[model samples]
Target: MHDHAHGIRQGDNRRLLAVSLAITGVVLVVQVAGAILTGSLALLADAAHMLTDAAALVIALVASAVAARPADDRRTYGYQRAEVLGALVNAVVLIALSVGIVVEAVSRLLAPEPAPVAGGWMLAVAVVGLLANMLAAWLLRHAQKHSMNVRGAYLEVIGDMIGSAAVIVAAIVILLTGWTRVDAIASLLIAVFIVPRAIGLLREVFSVLSESAPAGTAVADIRTHLLRTPGVRDVHDVHVWQLTRGAPVFTAHVVVEQEVLERGSGALLTRMQGCLAEHFDVAHSTFQLEAAGHEEREHH
Candidate 1:
């Protein structure tokens, strides 16, 4: 048996997340104050969403830092999965915030409350918030591709930006015509964007937690390739799962000829690991090279 991992590292995302965390924390305070002064549901919803963004960035920073630690005997796989856990939490929080905003918006729409909306003030605050969210989004854009933690933070800022835009539009309508219901309408629209992004994040986190195959990985192709390798007569118990985002692990049993096992077994193992690394981008793999009929013995 052998284990092969190409390259796995962490901590690189911490700096980006730290900057984002600071920006979100400051923006959250501003938005909250704006919501209070203007009593705009759209601004309030955007503030609430910003609060989650701050929390997500904080968790992402910590997770990235923890995952950077080297592997030890007590934890051979290291703390790489912490990032996925952080992402999972972020997704849940986003869903809750979205639901809360939607419910509040619906109530306001139906009840038609006399909201004290300061159009000019809310518009100014929202524009500032939008700029801040855009900056944070740009900082996290590149890292979000391979790291779920980064993606979670990126999505939050994007959602916040959308909410801010909706608030801006509402402010314009309120400024031009004395319509307060536009605020509630804008909040409802913001919720619409939030829910879909939250669902996507949830799906990605669940895939990792469930040990599902990583995106784009083809199990059948891998099996066929292994069978074609020299000295490999049979393949069974093959499995593939992601240890974390961008880190795939593979395990399988390969039946070999008796003579091949005795003379050049080590070489075959290297070839199998190499194929997985080069072709499939699989970093870690474990192969149990056995004599023919080993699969039958396992059943008993």
Candidate 2:
């Protein structure tokens, strides 16, 4: 039953990500066309933002497929890290694009250009972009909660949505007040929306790659919990990290109670695994069980 449910979940994720990629691709094209036709800096920035989102969706689809591969001799941990690598790459791309947009917006501000289309028409396209972004966000919402790959894509869609809204507002202001500077301000606002998100995502990606402790799951706190469990004496050489987006893997050297070690080491290990799973949500764990006489204190 569990295996069947797991298979169904995997199928659902693949289908959803594929559909998201298709939608993002179509929206990116439309946004780019709208930008060119309207000659609106705001529209162009939003189009660029959607372009990054489309790229993220494509990377996520490929990364998910790679992550499903079985463990091999060269990679004993399997290909799960592909998802993290995908996120890291996406973050780098976003940073680059954000920098480019900021530079262009600054240049345009110094030397303003007339918008080709009337503000009302540009506003109409911005509305369409906004709707497209919302739809994309909904498609990836569930997956984002569980997977970093989806989260990266979700962030891009969210940033694009904000960019679209900013463009719409700028268009309205341009129409009402004849403020050509509004387009440059909107472009800068789009960069403001993107840069911070890109920086945060890059930090997460590097943390995962560096095997830093998973956020919100402190190593000392986990050790203390394990020590309180039955049959556990001392814990050492402990380490924890995310195996994938949601799954965490842990390893520790555990000194068992003399009686428990004498009776059944295998049973003690099994009990410890259960305890770790129940308390810490650690899905995979490796505990080196040590008997009392053979145990020696070790520091991390």
Candidate 3:
């Protein structure tokens, strides 16, 4: 039943990503042309940023589709981790692109003379690019809340929007002051906007890849809750981690009174699972009911 609902959500996410990709693709071509015509480093940097965003959206789109595949004998968890991997790749690409832009901007700033920039052409193209970015952002806004892959694409679009704005500001400054160096300065600002968000996303990707417990969920708190259940003497080997965003998996060895075992472990198991689902928002859980001192007889 849950699988059916998840499939529906994945379908919606893919549609959103596709539309956003189309918008970005169009803007990317326009920006590239504008950059070449105006010889504005800021416009060129923004175009480069859009190019990567378009690629990232493609990766995210493919990953969203792959994540819908069912588990098989060879891959028990299915392809859900594909989304995480997609996010990882997006973060790495963003960081690398930002660093490259920064390096180029620095070199341009150090050049003997500032590069010529056509402020009028740059401004017109930047305005169009900013509008396209705004549209793409609106399309992905809700979907990003549900999937990390979508979130990565959404962040990239937002960065592109900022880059476009910087380009516009640089264009206006150049037009008023005849200062071409503002173009390089705008590229630096765009790069600055990208690095921190990319690093933050990378941190989240690592957390999921390492199988760390989801934020705000404490293993100790789960242990305490399980121990409070009727007939449960102790809880050990409690493991909690997420397969992906919003999908948490839990496993624990629960020691219960012999009387409860004699009465059948079924009811106790149900109670514990219910407790986890209700309190911890863990829907998929496995508990091994054990007789008192069962762990003592087993080699650790």
Candidate 4:
């Protein structure tokens, strides 16, 4: 039953990512042409950002598909970790793109005679790009909450939106005051917006890859909860981690009264599993019920 629901969600994620990728690809082509026609650094920077976003979306799409594969003999947990790896790649690409944009912006600012920028053309193109980004963001907003791969694509679209806005502002200022350096300044601002978000995403990807417990879940709290179960005397060797976003796995050795163990463990197991699912949002759990003093006998 859980597998059925998860498969549906994966299908939804892939559809959303595919639509967003199409939108971004169209915007990338438009922005590239706009930048060439307008000679605006802001537009060019936005185009470059979109280029990377399109690539990121492709990676996310592939990862989502791979993650949907069922577990096999060799790969017990399936390919869910593929999504995390995809997100990690997206973060690195974003950081590198931001650094490149910053370097170019600085060079443009230092130049004595800046390139001519056509304000009207830049404004028209930027507005179009902004509207496209908004559509893509709306599509991914809900899915991003549940999947790291979707979130990576969503963040890149958001950054593109900001870059478009910066380009529009630069165009307006150029039209009003004829200060072309604002175009370079706008590019710098876009780069600044990208780095922090990418770094934060990178941190989350690392946490998942390192097999750390899901955010906001404490192992100690899980141990305490398990110990409270009827017939459960103690809990040890408790382990909690995630296969992917929203997919937590838990395992623990539960010490129960000797009489309870001798009688049966079925009812106790159901109760403990229910407790974990209700309190900790952990649907996949394994508990080994043991007689008291069992831990003392086992070699570590």
Q: TM per model?
A: 0.91, 0.92, 0.92, 0.95
lDDT of 2 by residue, 1-300 (tens): 001011214456678888877877887788788888878888888988888888898898888888778778999777778888888888999989988888988887777455444677679889988998898899888888767877888999999999999999999998998887788789999998888898898888888887877788878888898888788878988988775577677888888878886787776676677777777777688888776555554331
Say which candidate scores most in TM-score.
4
Which has the higher TM-score value, candidate number 1 or candidate number 4? 4
Over the stretch 193-251, how does candidate 3's per-residue lDDT look in tens digits? 99999998898888888999988898999999888888989888888887777677788
Candidate 1, residues 1-300: lDDT per residue as tens digits?
A: 556453544555788888888998888999999999998999999999999999999899888888787779998888788989999999999989889988999988888455769999899999999999999999888888778888888999999998999999999999999899999999999989999999999998899889999889999999999999988898888889886777888999888999897897788888988898889988689988889887788766
Candidate 3 wrongly placed segments (more than 4 Å): 1-8
What lDDT would each prediction earn against the true structure? Answer: 0.88, 0.80, 0.89, 0.90
Higher-ranked by lDDT: 2 or 3:
3
Rank ordering of all candidates by TM-score, starting from the highest: 4, 2, 3, 1
Model 1, runs deviating above 4 Å? 1-9
What are the clashing pairs of model 4? none
How well does candidate 4 score on lDDT at residue 121? 97
Q: What is the descending lDDT order?
A: 4, 3, 1, 2
Q: Write the per-residue lDDT of candidate 4 for residues 145-213, one digit (tens) a residue.
A: 889988999999999999999999999999999999999999999999999999999989988888899
